[model samples]
Target: MYTDQLKRKLIIKKPIQRIVSLVPSQTELLIDLGLEEKVVGITKFCIHPYYLKQNKKIVGGTKNIKINVIKKLNPDIILCNKEENTEEIVAECEKIAPVHVSDIYTLDDCLELIHQYGNLFNCRTEADKITQKINFKLNDFKTFIHNMPKKKVAYFIWRNPWMVAGNNNFINHLLTLNNFDNIYNSKSRYPEIELKKIRLEGDPDFVLLSSEPYPFKEEHAFEIGRFTHHAKTIFVDGEMFSWYGSRLLKAFDYFKKLHNRII
Candidate 1:
């Protein structure tokens, strides 16, 4: 018996021989766990390994999983995230195999997920090593940001009815870790509001346009900058801020550069 991040018990009678990763970050994580051979199915968005598109069975996109494709693969365990995956999809996948749902909002949770994967896949040693590396880089980032001024930021994830990386989410947690205070801290998860409204309430010190979920480009940053005259607007890599897996090995370094650019 194994308990996932969601505290749901997973019954594993045998070694995990086939893994179907529904989340992009966890797909990279499974590979980092040295379970590459066991990764039989991945979503179309699981493009980290690049070769995955050519090698593995594409079960479908994160939001629109192909049931027939998934059934064909017959995964032993399906890795999912609470935010990235929907309840209906999870319920459907549950009928086939045990689904490990991860609800992540902090660095500790990420480290625990690595350990959980270790336990699930019988790779405790590799998990420990990856944990250490993530921690080491985390510490380095802390040191790098030491004595830096805390800056209020408006992190945009979408446009139209503009949405922000709000409080109590992984993006906000990572922002705080890097000393970027979310201006939308009072709001709930991914609140949709006008950039002009946010600027009127309190002009952020920085306005970040994320390169995901909406794929904000350099032009979007300039557009947001118009409303936030007091802020420095720039395009940020969404993966570094949102990815809760092995890609974190590179996040701290990216943060260092980001902070330097901000300063």
Candidate 2:
């Protein structure tokens, strides 16, 4: 019988209408995928695109999410990352809504994540166009940097702890793509090394201090500058190097500007 008491619950198969992104990279990706109206909440760390600051509600950071605030947002989908977000936060968010986690380390991982997001958002066409554009730009950058002499570069992610990006990181891949050889390839992922060791044998051609994780300032550069005589130390945007999403579309031009300034 079609009585309300005998009716079964229906499942909705529509695309997610409201999304809350825990990771900054995924937030930027969602925005790039034309999901601005769909995204209702974002982490405080999701500062890229600049306008997110004005429009999006802060649900907390990647490591620490405001679960109560998130519940209030009533997001249908919550996007996060394995490296950037903690398991507890993911589990808590799962209680509120379905959560999709992305793990990205290399260029291939980035492309795969893009494809997955495309499928998830029902925006496969736009995703394919973006992927093609990114691939073309990356290929062009590779060709341009291929002939140039490889420079030894040390990318710093933290200051007091003295942590630097290692071979398994996206920044390392980007550096290799840009014809810059990472001095910390021996170590895996972000490793803590002594400044004395860096002074003794690191001998990097360039020292890139990231703006996040430690917020390296110009004065800090002057401090590290003493150790590296041949290396030119500059404060670089952490997002440009680490974000593996649509932010990458804008990274090539930034890289070109950086290359021109350095070379």
Candidate 2, which ten residues in sequence have the lowest lDDT sum?
1-10
> In candidate 2, how many Å is residue 156 off?
0.8
| lDDT on C-alpha atoms for all candidate structures | 0.89, 0.82
lDDT of 1 by residue, 1-263 (tens): 89999899999877889999999999999898899999999999998988987999989899999988888888899988999999999999998899999999999999999999998899999999999999999888788888888898888899998999889899999999888888889889999887677677668988888888898877887788878866788889999999988999999999988987878
Model 2 reaches what TM-score against the true structure?
0.91
- C-alpha RMSD of each candidate structure in angstroms: 1.1, 6.4
Write down the lDDT that model 2 would get: 0.82
After superposition, candidate 2 runs with Cα above 4 Å error: 1-14
Candidate 2 structure quality by residue, lDDT tens digits, 41-61: 998888878878789899888
Clashes of each: 0, 0
Pairs of residues clashing in candidate 2: none
Badly placed stretches (over 4 Å) of model 1 are: none
Model 1 is weakest, by summed lDDT over 10 consecutive residues, at 194-203
